[model samples]
Target: MKSWGLLLVAALALSGSYAVDRNNFKTCDQSGFCKRLRGFKPEKSEYSLNLDTVLVHGNVLSAEVDTVDTTAQERKVLWHYAMRLSALVDGTFRVEIDEVDPLYPRYRTQLALDGEPKADGLKLLSNENGKLTLMNSQGHKVVIRATPLKIEFLNKAGDVAVVLNDNAQLVVEPLRVKKERIDDEDGNAVEVVSPLLCLYCFCDWILKCRQVFVFSALTAT
Candidate 1:
């Protein structure tokens, strides 16, 4: 009877620990920006940038971006954004977009790239006709075209696994400072929510639940 009780307790504890609400996590569809970006099609891109200002610093390259909206309704919204295309020492390409001059810089978390990837030995093959082709020492080729700035990662067999900005839906809004009053008719200040705060709250709740389960298991043992 004692051995059966211990086995049952172990099984229940393991199951409880493994059980997580997968739906609680957000997906690309749930994120407004990602959803818009993913649905973008290249044929609808009205903006194009010239590759006249390419500066290569070690493995990093910074470039000037000139975007023109050819769309009839959006033609009046012509804007320029600074683009930094960096090839990390580990051979992964890091592309970042932000406003040319923002009132406040957007939050880019370092946690996104927490670990180093394996070195893939990327080598610049050519940069002609506004297209840059890079071949890894292992013979894998990556082609980056810079009119609407599309990137495609290809394997040796010419199969594409990842593509960035191929559809030209990248949008970076410049941050603006507003001096509007916080309180209006009701005289109550607006509520502001922080992503970090929400993440911490969720983590705390999970930890507390796990603690309770562990305590119950210990008492049963």
Candidate 2:
């Protein structure tokens, strides 16, 4: 009887594993955010950091991030974001970016970290010529550029080990209520934008993983 029960359990497990169908999953092209990010290929970065808005509070450095819309004849600010950089203990760094005032709350993962990571001391090395440099006690350096906001991590040898937003592929989709399309008198679809409800930041698990990878690369060098 025991042998027969074991065999039945093994059969059920195998059947469950085979029930999963890979084709049911959506591909990157089918996803809106993934498609937008992967398809974006511009000569230069559309996003820029507002140097005048840079602020330093305690161990954190933040600035206003803006993106330009050149689709129209005249360029204009298409979206706004808030970027925060922090020097954490053990010579690690953290970079975060989110919409400034989103129309709706974006999804943010909370189980990524065990708890709040301790911050380390950051010494301002230089702030000029559209660049800001900071250093930690362990001789690690963090460089921030003004135009086309970029962050570079350098080791004691002054060699850049990791960089963020180097390809200008950083994208943040604005969260809004999904509304149905309506036809107007001219038989054209009229777009309707939902009202401003609330605002929040988004920190995904993928971003946290990237942060860990960067820290590992920086430390390995």
Candidate 3:
């Protein structure tokens, strides 16, 4: 615990000399990523997978994904996306969703799988009405609820173990670029990075897991 506290202190020091309200942990509003991404909650998801383009290779299944975004002014932009599903050896499925081509590069998770996932092979049960389901003999299941944009981890009895986007709060962030400005007498402005942007990239695990639940949780001994 002493070592952990020291590391935390060092991290705060590296971010520059700022007033430290050590007693207070800032609210969610203080987080730029939280403010920007959670500002608007959509009634429904606008993403759909193109089943016709689905490809299977070993234990990895992939396909083209599509989504439409509407601006506050009511203008809409069509975006391209991609999806990959992997069947793990331990009766688990790893689903990856990402954007294909965007105006700017977006953030992707940096967390690596703790161990190599064994490919147990998967059987596609259905792909109808924009919904997809995959299952293994152990009764473990992966279901993608496309309309409202949710994913479910199901147990053998068809009970939901974990759910992502259950609150209808799945907001896809578009690529954001740093703004260049000039504020000095010489007309030179230093680029300032929002703390929220830095935190979002640093907190990759929150986005990477996407409601992951393992049989055992990790803990430091």
Candidate 4:
């Protein structure tokens, strides 16, 4: 009887850790950043690179991106964003972007790239016109386009991942400061807002993972 009870406890612990709730997540439309980036129209991309800051060292390239803000009433806002393109030793390409100088740096979870990619065998093909193309050791072609930048991982089979600043809605708002609290007639400061942001952030992540999985599966099949 003790052995059976132990077995049941172990099974419950393992299952609890692996449980995933699909409905608790948000979709692409729910995430402000993802929605803005994915909705980008290729035809409207007037992406330009700051050639002077482009640096290539070994397998990593870092540069400054000056993308046009088409959604602004001014027609465009000169936003300074940083772009890092690295070829992982494992042959998986990585592309990342964030605001160069915001009032407060946004939080990014590095745990997102949790696992190492299998040895897909990637090789650099060409770098020209603000674009870099690489052919994986497995013959898969990955393209990294700078200026209104985007990253597309593709193979002879089809595209695996395509991330673009499509609608040019990249908005990294500075975290605002709260004003001094004013006490109510009862001599206590009233609660202003609830802690909903934490919940929202987690939901966004799960949504992104689900969307990516669905998109990859569809493309692969």
Top candidate by lDDT: 2
Worst 10 residues of 2 by lDDT: 197-206
Point to the candidate with the largest TM-score.
2
**Per-residue alpha-carbon lDDT of candidate 4 for residues 1-221, written as tens digits (9 for 90 to 100):** 99999999999999987897867989999876577556555444355556568776665566787756555667574566676665554435555555576555455544676774333334567778878776644455666676655556674576665444444433333233434466889999875532222111111123232112111212343
| Candidate 2 global CA lDDT score | 0.70
Q: Can you write out model 3's per-residue Cα lDDT over 62-144, one digit (the tens) per residue? A: 88766645333563546666777777666667666556755544444444656565676767789888777877546677777
**What's the true lDDT of residue 155 in model 1?**
59
Candidate with more favorable, higher lDDT: 1 or 2: 2
The deviation in Å at residue 219 for candidate 2 is 4.4
Error of 2 at 157 (Å): 1.8
Model 3's TM-score against the true structure: 0.61
Q: lDDT per residue, candidate 2, 106-160, as tens digits?
A: 5454466688778877778888999999888678888888776677889888889
10 residues in a row with least lDDT, candidate 1: 212-221
Off by over 4 Å in 2: 1-30, 70-73, 105-111, 180-221
Cα RMSD for candidates in order: 14.2, 8.0, 9.8, 11.6
TM-score attained by model 1: 0.51
Error of 2 at 3 (Å): 43
Worst 10 residues of 4 by lDDT: 209-218
* Candidate rank order under lDDT: 2, 3, 4, 1
Of 2 and 3, the candidate ahead on lDDT is: 2
